[model samples]
Target: MLRIHFAGEDIGRVRIAAGPVPAWEMLLSLHALRGPADHGVFGPWRARTLGVLDASARLLLRLAPPRGYSPDFLTPTADNDIDSLVDAVQSTARRRLRTDLGLLAAQRGPAVWMRPLADGDTTALRCVGTAMFRYHQRVLAPAWDRIHAVVMAERAARVADLLDGGVERMLSRLHPHIRWEAPVLSVTYPVRKELHLGGRGLLLVPSYFCWARPIALRDSGLDPVLVYPANRGLQRLVEPPDTSNGDSLAQLLGATRAAVLQEIGGAEGVTGTDLVRRLRISPASASEHATVLRRAGFIVSHRTANTVWHMPTPLGRAVLERDSGVRAGHGCQRSPARAGFTP
Candidate 1:
């Protein structure tokens, strides 16, 4: 952790002194550390701006989900394939991928700058480069290099690195007011066990479960050209996996109680005349749905005359698969009139 944080002064022995860190803390902290430090430096607003830019860059990638070879790490493999025929075909695959991404970088350079700012204000540009290097050379590059003579995996990394590299180079070209937290803070989050490399995994849940949507995205097995260019590497933080500690769905939102939570477009306090106008449902329909979700413990409802407001519970967040934005069809709930609501 320290070595990664400093990016200097190798402290491999430090691990002996620290002992093994619990998987959870190690993973979450590493993940958090990857976040652009500008947020930590310029305060929340600048940090948020950094986050927004990062999202925009990522969104540009996701708007066009990698539509090639299934990025499915879980794909089933054949038990027996003769190695004799494998060598020639593998070599071909590598060159093809590299060429595709190289072409992409050349064509869409501006849309995909590696880093956000000109100055190397943040370490993500560097760290991500390293991570990409490792995941490629060690993980996929070797296999592809042998199978595809041109080393498709390595080329893909090179192309992505080159394009994003331009962004980093630009950062170096002009210095910006960069920020850093020399000694990092311990921001605890509930994470899976494997993330903890050291045994000191802390058990703490953040008060607010929902944060600005996680930017992770995975290629959904729908593309092929990406396989040729190691650029298949760009991973957008998409929807997170469900939490085990979170409340159960049925317990939170009863079977036939109120409206479905996933369908609620936006009914926070019913203050939005626009929502009323848009939904076009009588005040009764709207209020009833809010009431059901409230009763199911998915939301908290309060009545101020004709206006009723609803806020979600942590349980609702898990079911909605999000705590922040409820894009289109999220957090829907409806109570059967037979079940009853005063509205």
Candidate 2:
């Protein structure tokens, strides 16, 4: 069990990441690749990644295990910028690198390369960084847009929860294994431990490929960060919809409109560009359909910064569910309207 004791000041300081952190995703996905062959959800992606993985890319496996410790320098913080994160890894202090590597070596038994890595060998560190960059290019770059969309959608949902019932409701619903009890938040960890926040608060990062349970940094002295798995429905963001359903729905609603609806149905908080990429439709066409749908009271569109996210209203979900032959209550749950969208 892992317990986090929070102070009054910590409540307002808790934050959710804007998107998936590149380095953390790279590390966790590598761990997932090494695990058992239950790739039913990610089978196509796994196959594609395996085909492109070269000798340099395979070196990342040594840094991350299927189950166990990974060095902290690999994922310095929950920053989402890939370039900055790679630089941080390369610039990790020699003392911290040696200490973190030694801890990993102790747990997994010494690897022959551990000595050089612990000795602050710049070549070894650069080699590891290069491998990480290659793996990201080969495995995650293609799907990053979709991955980010799912993460943002999840963040939007959590934000709604936070608004409706405050921190207690949001924290309790994070995962089935997590519980909020007064000033203490508890998680069922593989090992027994307690973390006193000391008022530094916590950073909540939602990950697309973080399997199963929530993970936290082993080092307590640093800021408290929790990496949790996003909702299971996020998988639909990567998968192509059923052909039969697509054809039937397209026939029911014109091809262009159906395609737009299908994409929005798969993932909420999607932008017009996302639709263009997924459907191979022109931007003008995507905008036209989104306007029509919004005007008809099927979907609601809102702008955050420069991007507009279209979310399916209850009426919209009913239309898709009825057309798809899904029972009314069984369709995707209607997400709450974002702050600016009109009813």
Q: Please tell me which predicted candidate would have the highest TM-score against the true structure.
A: 2
What lDDT would each prediction earn against the true structure? 0.29, 0.75
lDDT of 1: 0.29
- Where does candidate 2 clash, by residue pair? none
lDDT (C-alpha) at residue 31 in model 2: 83
lDDT of 2 by residue, 190-234 (tens): 988788888798999888787788888888887898888774453
TM for candidate 2 is 0.74
TM-score of each: 0.19, 0.74
What's model 1's TM-score?
A: 0.19
Superposition error at 251 for model 2 (Å): 4.2
- Per-residue lDDT, model 1, residue 162, is 37
Q: Write the per-residue lDDT of candidate 1 for residues 1-343, one digit (tens) a residue.
A: 1111222221121111011111111122223333555433213322333343332234223212232211121111111122211222122233333443344444455334422312232343333233333332332332221222112222222223336644233212111111123322112222211121132211111101012211111222212101111111121122123454243334434432223354442332233243345556566655555544544445443222243334444445444544332333355543353124321
